[model samples]
Target: MKKTISFITENFNKSSPDLVGGFQGFQRAINMEKEDIIQEIVLSGLKGRGGAKYPTGKKLMQSAEHHDKEKYIICNADEGEPGTFKDRELLLHDPYGVFEGMLIAAFAINASHGILYLREEYKYMIDDLKNALNHMRSLNLLGDRILKTELSFDISIFLGAGAYICGEETSLIESMEGKPGRPRIKPPYTLEKGLFSKPTLVNNVATFSTISAIIRNGYEEFIKYGTVESPGTKLISLCGNVNKPGAYEVPFGMTIREIIYDIGEGIRNGNSFKFAQIGGVSGPLVLPKHIDTPFSYEDLNEIGVPMGSGAIIVVDSDNDILDYLDAVQAFFKHESCGKCTPCREGNRQLLNILSRLREGKYSQEDTINIEKIAKTMKYASFCGLGQSAPAALLSAIEHCPQEIFKRRD
Candidate 1:
């Protein structure tokens, strides 16, 4: 297969370098100056790959601007989303990339401590990260004065119990603080009150990992890959009935068709493509009509969908859209912490309506009620999971109403 994206292609030259493979002596601190590092990251136009699309440099600058006697950096590696494994691949293949990124972030923000919070299920990555940490320590990369510079930083690995809600930044902080993973109300955001109620910056593994390339090559070089609004490459985990089902790093503006047909080598076994979920559960269900849509935050949002955690799940003609909706609803229902009544009750009611639809008990009235409940969940819920719970169901119903509304007589 011909590789079209430069992000993966450029990195492929190293192709699992020995330094990334638990070997010591690779310089943890590169020769690049700190100002150059910030400029490079700013030019790269990188955004958080965790789906929010927040500008990476801006985040670092915000933290840097607020540097105080105590500040912390956090790498969110809890890959709990269904069908998303891009972070796992990055951690397994290029653990040092993440470490290097975190170090740069720590330096930029003058943070004294860093932590990589990973899911316990990713045992391999956890072990790999530990090995990488040890390797860095042996070279005097992690402890005390790093690379003989005045900057001192250390990273600790915290294993999460694998709750999906912990993927939320504040919730991850709450989890690391030895509490149940429930998202806190924002406005005194993580940059202000996070991790032990101190100033902190929490970013995804991929977002931090990209820092290596930015610092190494310069921001203009990084900016060469993506569009104006969303610069830099994004790693997408392509799964579900695609010829190529692994993770691949592609430029941000690439079309869905390019990813599906070219990169994925077209649907598996000649099955006709039905639809695809651009993001995870929080993302909207994209139909055939939206195939040409550019894979960027703005583009997806303008079209009523959000480019979430970059999990591209392709569904074929054989798959039932309603069943998929049911599964998604079940996930939200099960994961709801029940702190809020609308989410707790709204999710259960949505599940029941889906069950009624599946059993042919749904009338037009039931469908109307389902829509109403979904709207309520969207506006009334406290956190993101609850607010976005209706994304899949709403998209499925909007795009494939016939499939959902079909009578069983």
Candidate 2:
């Protein structure tokens, strides 16, 4: 069967019939019953692709249910994960899809304002999004009286300084408000108190982009593509030693073997695959034994790893796993924001321990101490960054235990 969605397939490349018709379809769908749209989305089982994997329809429903006078829709385009760049690709080639998705979300939640919180490093995409916004405005798809309806919605592009933590919804809102990007405590979730302390629906760019297609095709149709739980498709950025390293939109339950071999064309230069990082830096490292493990949030979680940010970094036997762990430790240390002591000091200490180990100065006793510190940090850190920072290291220790052991005389 021919695939409907493929890796790197630019859905919004040219002014084709489908592209023009998609806007018209969205305009018509926006006028349809909001409850029906919600039902369709719920049936679709679309989850947030921005690492959290929260139900998109459920999030919109919460915002809709808690509709105060001022509700907002936020498109999280701050693709800050180190190895991930799929959102950047979507924004670059499919800006219209994202805009339509935002509009659909705004219509669902009765929101007036929409903000695309994009990263500053995505300069080309930012420019392209701005131009796309202008095009939508020219066609009267945005602004007051959208598509001749009473619904008045407008989208603004809010640029973010290159901060990884800001990719979190709360931090993104804070950054957009001209404050330092620090994650706020949950409980009073974004749907309750978000940007400007109003009810906001913040979703990733890819998650929102899928909304239009879901609304147009119905939820059941969308669900036909992937597993019952992880419905629809996922775009994963395959990098590091892959022959055809790029973005690939595959079904959710596809194995790592399928991704690396079928889609990625196997390892480069015939190098044997030793291990792989299923998610971004904050995700766990999977050894060759877990190659058959399906790529899904639940599957990864069951195995004590997370498919966070959908970035798979393959490592060969020749690569030093300890060095990779050290790099991960350093990344968390540098990006910790120093908001809380556990993360602030914990990451620093962890990096120091890893550095000492690298210099062949740490014994097994030091390794035990390092593990203890990581456990403390996991429980005490303020946000996901600090909490999951030790995952890479821990997974490395589990799979490559001998790598950390010193051969003494």
Candidate 3:
């Protein structure tokens, strides 16, 4: 079996007391220039775990530079992506670590408030997270003048109604403002205008957890885990047709074949691996030919795959690829917020085509139209959802064509 390279999750235990000493580096950073804190994080080479893979340090630096306003820090704990459950585990077992990361982020950007945009499905984790926050407050780790320093940062958990799009930063902000969950346009990106139209820094659940580890252990130790191009560890939720379906924290540079056979213990019930979707539905579709492809931001990006949310869903040979694509299209069609023309219309069109194809009634025109619509969505869609929905079908057309169409042109 392939082994795991656990770094952030090394001390995972549900009953352990909230970490008391890990806040030292963050505290020390407060006494120095805010730029110094941002520099330390930049050196760590941590990318956004929320699928965008944007440099965490660069995002923090931009937020840090905006010193005139009350910036906000957000932890996107909405684990809504299909096959992703690593964030839920983090909150249940390491609530303190999450808080520590939020605190560090708040202090780094000189923000006074922080929010954890938790999904409603994980509502059971609220009490544990709340209790951990209350405990940290009492210990002077949170709330006014943290650790007896000038920095006074506080954090709170905000529950989200069950909406997949709410996991998006702008949509989460919209939901927080009591509006329907939907993504906002860019140019004034979330880093500049987010959370009540203020400068906000949003990160995924695993992103914040990893932040605590970097602050505590120093970025050098964290950097040693992954490659230079995509340094540091990643928490991947590996499921579907795997003998072992669970989360594993591993370094980058491992092949998909290694992750499936070694870490996931191979396909379930002796079924052969057919393909895998890395980074959830919004991520890229992998084929048998690409099994040896390294699992890293650089490697995956080169193949036009977005390392979305770190979810690896394996599909075995026994499963129906046409039916699978239909379900995938249905998800995007249902979850689409309908604010934009492209995502709303595009996903619906894809679903209709998938349905026809599933019924063995597809044509040459359907095949040609599929790629054209996917390209349109990719280029003209307003947000990541619409832009990313075409990945699987597009990959299928180019890679696994026989699996998608009943009659070829």
Q: Write the per-residue lDDT of candidate 3 for residues 181-273, one digit (tens) a residue.
A: 988777689888788878889998888888878877788999887788999889999999999889899899998888999999999889988
Return whichever of 1 and 2 wins on TM-score: 2
State which candidate, 1 or 3, has the greater TM-score: 3
The per-prediction CA RMSD against the true structure, in angstroms, equals 2.7, 2.1, 2.0
Best candidate, lDDT: 3
Instruction: Predict model 2's lDDT versus the native.
Output: 0.80
CA lDDT of each candidate? Answer: 0.80, 0.80, 0.84
Error of 1 at 337 (Å): 1.8
Indicate the residue-level lDDT of 368 in model 1: 95
What TM-score would each prediction reach against the true structure?
0.93, 0.95, 0.95
Shift of residue 379 alpha carbon in model 1, Å: 1.0
Error of 3 at 252 (Å): 0.7
Weakest lDDT window of 10 consecutive positions for candidate 3: 14-23
The list of candidate 2 runs beyond 4 A from truth reads 1-4, 7-10, 15-19, 407-409
Displacement of residue 354 (Cα, Å) in model 3 is 1.5
